[model samples]
Target: MSSSIISDATSKVKNMVAGEKGRKVADLDSVSQTVSPDDRITSDFGVKMGNVDEWLRVANEKKTGPMLLEDSFSRERIHRFDHERIPERVVHARGAGAFGNFRLFESIEDLTTAGVLTDTSRETPVFVRFSTVQGSRGSADTVRDVRGFAVKFYTQEGNWDIVGNNIPVFFIQDSIKFPDIIHAVKPEPHNEVPQAQSAHNNFWDFVFMHTEATHMFMWTMSDRAIPRSYRMMQGFGVNTFVLVNQKGERHFVKFHWTPELGVHSFVWDEALKLAGQDPDFHRKDLYEAIDNGAFPKWKFGIQVIPESKEHDFEFDILDATKIWPEDLVPVRYIGELELNKNVDEYFPQTEQVAFCTSHMVPGIAHSDDPLLQGRSFSYFDTQLSRLGINWQELPINKPVCPVMNFNRDGQGRHTITKGQVNYWPNRFEARPPATAQEGAYPEPPFNIQGIKARTKSDKFREHYNQAQLFFNSLSEPEKNHLAAAFSFELDHCEDPIVYERMSQRLADIDLGLAQTVAEMVGGTKPEKQTRANHGKKASKISQVEFAPAKPTIASRRIAIIIADGFDNTAYSTVKATIKAASALPFTIGPRRSEVFPAGASKKPGNGVQPDHHLEGMRSTMFDAIFVPGGAESIKTLAKSGRALHWLREAFGHLKAIGGTGEAVELFKLAFALPDLRVSATDEAIESYGVVTLSKVSPESLRESITIAKEGVGFLEKFLYQISQHKNFDRELAGLNSQVAY
Candidate 1:
């Protein structure tokens, strides 16, 4: 080729690349059409329509006759409506998605040459879908099941997907058993009695039969399964992948996403109550957080292991049921992800968004992990079945980069290629594949030594070690919760064989845990160990260890209960303080109508209106509750059983509780605990996660709201308690159990 011709071609390619760098959002906007009141109704083919609400009937206004089938507009509307529902996902069906950007804070050029990971200047667009694994599209969000944390990165190279889960491991080691595990955990095939619940006979029976599921089932039973919110959970790739550097040096990598808000979960009772009170709790929480400008963020990290030392660990690195303990392989955080925008529409954007584990850019490749290899094929196949052959052309799933290939048309094909031929090696040498030097995906050569057989490695046989490690690693309160979870699940299993086997199975991790669950579920109490406890522990396995470096109340929901005679000064000051701290404050009264505060007129405009009535919302909806002092307000609350239940339920759930002045007397009456202390003078008393000020004044309330280990002021102490996600001390001291919530 001539110099000038070559120069022009290179310049054109550079311009195209530059234009596609940050065009993901713009590309979607081009295909998106907004509805307006000024626009008229139109047919499927863009023809103007006058009457869409009524069908074309061959009759007068007085009498109706048979509808005319010749009306193309009516037929088209009916046909579209009839075929509107597409196939929902077989798993991870209940989900919420948001658009965001991934920014690399540190480059890992030496580990991998993938531009998205090695390029620090690029702000790669990302769409993340948070989901519950076993539920249908209509199921509740707070079920005790694994959460799907899938992310799609629209990088300049192409679209890369990290289809992961909140847990770091799987229920089974091999993909062949994927269907079996999911089938057992899902609603039973015969009755379909349980919806989005694992507390059943089949699940326990399956786990007992296949000991490999022990570790993952432990995670489900722990608080991890019922996360407080999608924004507060960790995401793990759960499968081992490979990264090849420029030198062709291969390394095994595991992906991690640590949330900035810290890991937290609802108490089992609270989760159960919220599932009925608000089935869309988690979905709405994600939307509300982003809409209120409190965008959720996570730090992206990777744990890399050289191929030469893959067998350095006792457990198989590629085993889907095991975790590469962070104590051994510390995560190297290199990037950050933030969800700043919600989807414009639910059907086209969130529902139609698909993910495949096979999607990858240059310098990244799948490992020989048995489960991962199967997922690469299964995910793509599932998408094809759900969204047709040309699913990739969907607006939400399309890549921003130029895609030039000889692939022809299929169902729902959107691209219109203008050319004489769609074949490679044509007479014009058109659209040839790129060379290695031009960013082509490199395939690292490896030797195959094993025979083709259906067998697992010896390391896969050792399953109980890690399960014991996880149980031993948890905090005391977490251990108690896990035990309670096991007991509850076993109790739900009507089959005696199922619960009895599971009870003995717990002995492999801890004898005390086995005995506790066995006694609670009417199983023969295990007196001796089934398998000796390994007595080993790993760090960062407990959610408590994932607490944020600094305390914060941002995005926390606080409820302010009041009546006709509530203290205006205390209420106003606390509400303003909560908003200033970037936390949400909701007013709750007997009714949604305006309620007169102390000395305020009983007029519509003069009184304060509550965000919700006591009967409309429960204490399960808020993270904390505050009651300001007023003689009449306190008396009204004391007389109402619902209001008393609110205080007790918050206390039983170990949530932060605050009260001032006469409110302290109401708390004492509601709790009725002689051991518990309340302030009597202008002092703040914080006891068992409850903060109260018996006397309130402007001078006392003027103190700064800085959180301290031993908070001096009332607001400081209350806010400090709120910052701590939960107070396990109350549960440990047996104070929460005493409450009759």
Candidate 2:
């Protein structure tokens, strides 16, 4: 052969070796590429192409003929577009995710040997996905459904996934009934009605039959179902797991993630309105908060029971439908989780990420919890069908630590191990498994001797105790909301039997609750309780107890409504005060165009430009509303029915409302409640979360924004009310129902 031919053959062989060995990749950023105008369009195989707009065809200069099958570029483009989507998760189909870090504030070395929980010096990287359980990918975010809170911790040892939900308990005790509960709550099979809702006949009937679902169903019907934002909700690892220490001791553990901002939820009417006004409300809220540098943080806690004391609980610790009362087993907060980064791309980062209950690092092992066991199996199997056998190799799912194994050759396989041997204990001792001493997972020895049977423990049968406890623990406003939720859901059940049976089932928890819902839904009102109420209450079960130690208005959305002639001084000062407190302030005007102040010209660009117009966004999208004073501005707002409705709706929803000077008269006119009070002088007065000041000055408007229980100034009082989240006192006093929006 010639010398040139031999050189070409040698180059080809070197390229093949490089391909099998695989190029070294340092991190996720190294593999990521940014699209720019400077880069040329190319095929998947990296061939630059021309004339992408037209297909290869046999035609004259002006007329085009049938496209040719030999057009590789067109064929490749069409093929890629056809298979762009993978099957979404059977549950948690709609979700939003972010990247963050988990830091151990207090080492819990005695409880477990896991480094993420024991090493206070280390910051473990994490990815958290917040989702709705029953919704499809296109469903609205504000629907009344259980929220999925799954966190994947990419620790040094391996990836540990805490597959959990906003509510600690699940709908069923055992995993065998998982399909039944999901099917019942999902859109009905016959006509597929009621998408992403439990207010249906089949769901009510299923809960009535399965008594174990009583506790979880009560939680679903509470305000917890409609969270205001993903950042404001608590997350719980519902299934029980085992934590083993260096001393070879085991303890039953339940995980908890409490938000730093405290738990808050939208009123039913507000939630319902936002579902139609903005289906991506929650998703946008999360992304915007992170983008604005108001990173959401959560306290990591664990409720632990010693191996010998596991059987001491009144309810089975392994049951998925029950919660260990905090009064009995207190939570020990040891770490903190803060999400600081948003994903670069939705498809590659958020959508492709997969979590498994079976993914646990060393020192953490699965308990014999029946529901958890089946979940561990089901999650892995489901990923196979959706992402194929080599799902773990995906960048979003791959572990940070080295992965050396004999397993190879599957669809979408990216790793190319350069080796002749692919088996363990081979002549070369290739890819041998690590022992427990070599940072491997250790299995604790425990005695297990039982006959194979399909039965739960006797304690699991006692379901009404905790359900009653949860109801009794709630505040009066919370109780009313829960009852109202029950009424609304049952009313949606067209079948008489489903609603009637469910109404009677409520008597098992509380007679008054059963009777209240029964009357509203037209069911037979129960005069007596079916089962005597234990009247037991537990701490931390009610969301009111989750309030933060210090009040904060950070990241809250406050809308400032104004017209053409508004008080520029008060508006500008209040907006600055809100921003200084780290809260978001938006201007809502009659038009998106510039609106003039009291003295400014009404010409183009001479006044302030509103962020959004009145009809463009509703009061439901904000945490509070404020209207600055100006006689002309107040007169304009007073004459417009939509503007009056905005104030009334905010009042009915129990949100904080504020006004200064002439705007105070607008509030009085809009509310029109004889019982409602407004400020008559320069001093600020807050009644039922309606803070108003009859007069305004630069000094008065510039008062320090302190969030005290009883704020002394106009700005302070208004900020304090915003921090409180909602004015439940108005609802309890029956004032909220008196106004018409």
Candidate 3:
């Protein structure tokens, strides 16, 4: 909330680059060119000034004893800085965005009259912005954070943005403590050291004490927190909304977006390294995926609960931090979204597209989830201060639909009314807007009669049940990731009290998880605590169950590492097969380019374009890797310890591996693996995604093709598992029985 936090505007990237390249914005030539805090201009009272000329600046060395208190310059500068920041959003501040389009699969007029959902024949242009809560805009992207999934569908009816997050629930049920939760989660005011992270004393102190945050914390610690790619994460509208049919029937609904590619996350170690290697990993990945023509897509669906049965379930539908289990309320697939393009500008489009919870059309309405209520008011109000009073008139925020109103404009107005009579009076016939029935936006009236009084809903008090459910839902690997995440974050906190309290919070969620975290962080568990509400039942809210309806190798990338002395016979065959399977096959070697044999000499330029140089690339950068066989090529690969380690790392991550001819022996040597010999039979090929023949005959090329197809096949079979994250159960079981133990 203080100006100090936001004022530390000098970015790591900005400081590391730019000056070396002569000061073009967004350059990374050298670190010294970074903007230094001391070199920046400051106000007379010592505050770092954002604008030098705007303030009353001293013209000479002589201090003119405070001149006329009416000096316009001083007053204007201070006045502007006085309101420099609107309230940093109540939640979800740091974010990234993209431009795209949403295509309808089938008309849903039978369910609702909303044009975007019902207009199956049209393609609606769209803008999507993803964000992280708690951190300021300058924070890193890979922290154990909940992502905001706010999509603005610029439809003919109007812009409909299902403002949501990757998580289905929030930290609390009621809106009253929204500010309290955010404040506690934000960097400590006395000294804001931990930026973009939530393992501090204040955050854990809040979670352990309140207990309502248990469910959310579990998610924050799991693999979901460290997504491998934004393309592989699912999105959920955290609050319930209403869909009205043409018959005036209202159906309570929640929006769901299941990634077509599947859910995936990086190991914690890789994620942490990425924070330093590339804090913009997510934003860049999203942009690159689109740029590469591998457009990211998510299947759009809605879970509709009939209003007549609003009280059918024991839990109140209006609770913000609770979810309606998929088994109970199955999601009906309605459409799909494909992000085919990236934005050309960041400031005007991606940065300024405001998503308001109250931006609803005639057929869609709001639910009274208290947090939803607070957001509807907060988003609009904050935009006014952040962008001028007429923020909607800004290009990015303005509605694409036609606009006509009797209301006059304010600061930054771009429109001019022709009529002299600005006030709507009878004398001026048809002078202004009237009657809500004439396609003039109208809100359905729901009668209310009550003596106004502040009250808390009882349903909100039963918080820990869902939290318990979320913890119990994680698989062993997922649980390990969660526990490891807890230890990693808490270990960073200076205060032992922070770790001690947070350790107990984990224990309360799952004893095993708590015990593991305690061991890792060297912290003692607190005295046993009761559930936030013991009698509450566990619910279904986990990623383990979210899988694609039909699994395919579609856009998954398979990197084939090749080099000189590679067998052209085996190489030619694998390339053809990978292309046929529809998965991209990128050849990588020690050099940027490799050639086929120039008259049987292991050499350059026979006929292949190397996509990457192995030393400069890492296995973590690709989905899977393959080695094609040649005696000399395998020998070259074996010598590069880095290339060998790439295979071992990929195997440890359970990624699919492929090989043929002598390359199979190279893979064995790379991992120090024992011999795994087999003839080029269909069964052997089917099992390991590897194929080999005694020697290269024309038939061997056919066999190599089979090997590549097998790798593609293996990817297809395990795509669901890859998306669900890793196999933690297999990992834990292996660890327990390990002689390494």
Off by over 4 Å in 2: 1-26
Candidate 1 lDDT: 0.91
Q: Per-residue alpha-carbon lDDT of model 2 for 1-741, expressed as tens digits?
A: 576765665565456545534533235445578889999999999999987999999999898899999999999999999999999989999999999999999988897899988999999888999999998999999999999999999887889999999999998888889899999999999998889999999998999999999999999999999999999999999999999999989999999999999999999999999999999999899999999889999999999999999899788999998999999999999989999998888987888899999999988999989899999999999999889999998888887766767898989998887756677675544445778887888877889998898897888899899899999999999999999999999999999999989889999999999999999999999999999998889999888998888999999999999998899989999999999888999999999988999988778877999999999999999999999999999999999988998999999999999999999999888988887889999889999999999978677787466788866899999999999999999999999999996
Deviation of model 2 at 47, angstroms: 1.8
**RMSD (Å) of each candidate, 1 decimal:** 2.2, 4.6, 12.0
For model 2 the TM-score comes to 0.96
Please give the lDDT score at residue 531 for candidate 2: 98
TM-score of each: 0.97, 0.96, 0.79
- Minimum summed lDDT over a 10-residue window in model 2 is located at 20-29
lDDT of each: 0.91, 0.91, 0.67
Ranked by TM-score from best down, the candidates are 1, 2, 3
Better of 1 and 3 by lDDT: 1
By the TM-score metric, which is better: model 1 or model 2? 1
Q: Summarize candidate 1's per-residue lDDT along 1-741 as a digit string, tens digits.
A: 676765665566466546656465578657777788998888879899998888988998799999998999999988999999999999999999999999999999998999999999999999999999888999999989899999999888889999999999999889998889889989998988798889899988999999999899999899999999999999999999999999999999999999998999999999999999999999999999999999999999999999999999999999999999999999999999999999889988899999999999998999989999889889999988889999988989998887778788889999887656678776445656899998888887888798889997899999899999999999999999999999888999999999888888888889999999999998988889979887889999999999888888889999999999999899999999998888899999999999889888787798898999999999999999999999999999999999999999999999999999899999998898877889999988989889999889897675358766676889999999998979899999898899999
